[model samples]
Target: MAGHPLKKIQCESIARTSGKQCRAKGYLKKSGHYRCRFHGGASTGAITLEGKLIAYKNLKQFKNYTDEQLLIWIQNKLQKSSSV
Candidate 1:
């Protein structure tokens, strides 16, 4: 309730084709994955991108959350209704 919730399309879990676009239902389980099992959801890894545009985009979306916050966020069914 402390921050603004994100606005996006809710991925249709039933459709399968566009399921990844779902609002915040979130993917199946794994340590570091957020997408469904079909979309590399069980991978543990990180890659560094080299681009100011991409960097800014990431920063803007994740500016309020930390590594720890992300873990908690994911645990709570990817809920964006509250602050991360």
Candidate 2:
């Protein structure tokens, strides 16, 4: 039997102790995750409004847009939703 080829991605987080990126290669377990175990692999979702906005802006399905464009999009959407 043939063995499966391993897949890995470099972690996208910076290390606190080293003041540099962790960059450890790891297998992805879920959508849009790129960090290894020691570099925030297990967690999902952003806690703050700013974090949420940033995460939303980076989603793959979203059109490539400037941060200002995304922020404006979010505000318009939220305003419409809240008023309805």
Residue pairs in candidate 1 whose N, alpha carbon or C atoms collide under 3 angstroms: 10-22, 10-23, 11-21, 11-22
Q: What tens-digit string does per-residue lDDT give for candidate 1 at 21-84?
A: 5445345354443543444445443333223333444666767776666555444633563556
Clashing residue pairs in all predictions, respectively, total: 4, 0
TM-scores of all candidate predictions against the true structure: 0.22, 0.39
Q: Per-residue lDDT for 1-84 in model 2, tens only?
A: 234325445677778989887757754666666768775547666766688688897788666887787778778977898999
- lDDT, residue 78, model 2: 70
Indicate the worst ten consecutive residues by lDDT in candidate 1: 45-54
Error of 1 at 8 (Å): 38
Q: What is the lDDT of residue 10 in candidate 1?
A: 32
